[model samples]
Target: MSSNDLEICKRFAAERAVLDREFKGNVVVGIGSGSTVVYVTKCIAETITRMNKEAEKDGRKPDLNVTCIPSSFQAKELILRNNLNLGSLESFPLVDWTIDGADEIDSQNNIIKGGGGCHTQEKILASCSKELYIVGDYTKYSPKLGTNWKKGIPIEVIPVSYVAVKRKIECRLGGEVLLRMAVMKAGPVITDNSNFIVDWRFPEGIDNWKDIETTLKMIPGVVEVGLFIKMAIKIYIGNEKDVKIYDFSPSNE
Candidate 1:
C-alpha cells in the first residue's frame, strides 16, 4: 500500500485492537480529538452494531449500554454522527476507560497532545477515567517527546492573557513560543473552550518533563499544557507491519 494508505491502515489496526480489548458492555467511554481518533469512533460504532446484532440473534435485548463522552466539539460531532449514545462528564462523573490519539509518544509513554486545541477537555476526561489509552501510527512514536512532533507543545491559554503567557513561556521555559493562528479565520485559532492556543517549541533532549509540566501549569491564564506526564496506562502504536503495545511501568513514571 501507499504510505498514506499504510498509515491509515495502521491507525485502523490500532484502534480496532483497542476497541476489542477495552470496549465492553455497559461502559462509559471518553472519545478524544485528533485525526487518528477518527478511527476510534468508527470502530466503536461498528462494534456496537455487531454486538447488537449478535444479541438479537441470541434472542436477547440489544442493550450494549455504551455511552460516549466527547473531549471536544469535533469529538462530540463524531459521536453523534456515528449514532452513538452521547454523555457528559457531569452526568456520568466516572468513565470506565478513555482512548485518545497522541501527537507524539515517547519511550516513557509521555505524550504530547492538544494538537487539535482540545487538550484542556481531553485532559479532564482522561483524569476522570479509570484508564487512559492512546492510539497512533508509527510516525507518532519517538524516543523523546520533541523528537517527532515538531509542532511544539500545545498550550491552551486565555485569549486576553495569550500575549503575556507566550512571553512567560518563552522567557522562563526557554522556547520559541508562537500563537497558533487560525487557518480559515482572521486571528488566532480559538479552542472549543474559546481559549487561544500557544505552541511552545522547547529544546530537544530535555530530561525533566515533570518539572516543565508543573511550571507550565503554574502560569496564569494557562488552561492546560499538552504534556501528559505518566497519565497513560498504555499506548497502541501501529506500524505498517503490526501494532505494538507499550505498557506503563513505575520506572517510566
Candidate 2:
C-alpha cells in the first residue's frame, strides 16, 4: 500500500480497537476531531449496528444505547452522517469516555491537539469525560512534546484579543506566535467558538508542561490551550502491524 493508505489503515485499526473496548452499554461518548477520528465515528456506528442486529437475532430489545457528543462542528457532522444519536455537554453533562486524535503524544502521554482548530471544545469534552482515550498512527508518537509535531501549540483566543494574546505569548512565553490563517477564506481561521487560533512555535526540551498549560490559560482572552498534560488515561498507537496501547501510570513521573 501507499504511505497514505498505510497510515489510514493504521488509524482504522487503532480506532476500531478503542471502540471495541470502550464503546459499550448505554453511555454517552465524546467524539473528538481530526482525520483519524473519522474512523472512530465510523467504527462506533458499525458497532451499534452490529449490536442491534445481534439483539434482534436473540429476540431481545436493542439495548445498545449510545449517544455521541461531538467536540467540534466537524465532529457533529460526522456523528449525524453516521446516523448516531447526537448529544451535548449541557444535555449529557458527564461523558463515560472520550475518544480523540492527537497531533502528537509524548511518552508521558502529554498530547498536543487542536490541529483542526477545535481544541477549545475538545478540551471541554475531555474535562467532562470520566476518561479520555487517544487514537493515532505511529507517526504521532513522540518521546516528548514538540519532538514530532512541529506546527506549534495551538491556542484559541478571543477574536478581538488575538493580537494582544499573540504578543503576550511571544514576549513573555518566548515563542514564534502565528495567527492561523484560513485556507479558503481571506483572513485568519475562525474557530467554531468564533475565536481565532494562535500557534505558538515553542522551543523544544521544555521540562514542565502543566505549568505552561496553566500559565497559558491564565492569560485573558485565551479560550483554551492545546497542551493536554496528564489528562489522558490511555492512548492507542497504531503501527504497521498492530496497535500499541499506552496506559498512563503515575510511576512514569
Candidate 3:
C-alpha cells in the first residue's frame, strides 16, 4: 500500500482515541511516538481548547487542561507544535492514560511496537499509565501478532550486546535477527536513548507471545522488547471505511 493510505489510516485511529471523551477531569496523558501520534497530539490540543470554551460558557472556570508526557523526541515535538503543556515523567510519573501506535496487534491483544525506535520509552510510559490504548491501521490489525507485521519484533539492545543478542535470538528462540539499518544515515539506526534496534523475524507467526516476551526480556543487554504482552487495554483500528474498537479484557483474553 501507498504511504499516504497508511497515513490516512493512522490519522483515523488517532482521531478515534482523541474523540473518546474519556478526558473529563484534569488528566496527565502519556503521548507515544510515530507518525500516527502526530495527529493524536493535534486532536488533544484542539479538544482541550474546545472543552475549556465549553467550561467557560457553563461558568465552570475553564478548568480543563492536560499535561502531556511524551515518549520520544518526535512525540515531544508533536506536543509542542500543538501548543499543549508539556510534562515529564519525573514529575507526573503516574498518568491517567497513554496512547501509542503499534506495528502490529493480534486478536489475543498482544502488540509489537517500536518500528520508529521508541519502544523503550513507550513501554515505560504505558507502564506508568492507568490505561494503555494502541492505535493503528487495519493493515496492522492481525489475527495473530506476527503475521501482517513483516518488520518483526523490534528489540532495543545495548550497542555492545547486539551480536550476542542476535545470536541468542536465532539459536535459542528460533528467529532471524537483523540489526535495523538507518535509511538516511549510514550504520545502524540509533534510538533516542542511544540504543540499537534489532528486528527478530520468526519463520512463522508467534503462537505463545507471553512466553516469548518473558524469554526475550531475560536476555542480558536487552533494554526492552517490542512485544507488548497484555499491555494494551484497548486497541483502535482504522480503515478506509471506519474505525473499530476492540476491548482486551483479561477474562476475554
Top lDDT hit: 3
lDDT, candidate 3, 1-253, per-residue tens: 7889888888899999889847666799999988789889989988888888888888888766689999999989998999999999999989999998988888878888989999999999999999898898888888887677788899999999999999999999786999999999999999999989999988684588889889998999899999888888889998887899998856766
lDDT of 2 by residue, 37-152 (tens): 88888888888898889899999988788999999999999999999999999989999989998999998768999999999899999999998888888888999888878899
Q: What TM-score quantifies how close candidate 3 is to the native fold?
A: 0.94
Residue 129: error of model 1 in Å? 0.4
* Model 1 ranges with Cα > 4 A deviation: 1-3, 22-24, 249-253
Each prediction's TM-score versus the true structure: 0.93, 0.94, 0.94
Which of the two, 1 or 3, has more lDDT? Answer: 3
- Model 2 off-target regions past 4 Å? 22-24, 249-253
The residue-level lDDT of candidate 2 at 193 comes to: 86
lDDT of 1 by residue, 197-246 (tens): 99999976688899999999999999899998888888887877677888
Sorted by TM-score (best first), the order is: 3, 2, 1
Which regions in candidate 3 have their CA more than 4 angstroms from the true location? 1-3, 250-253
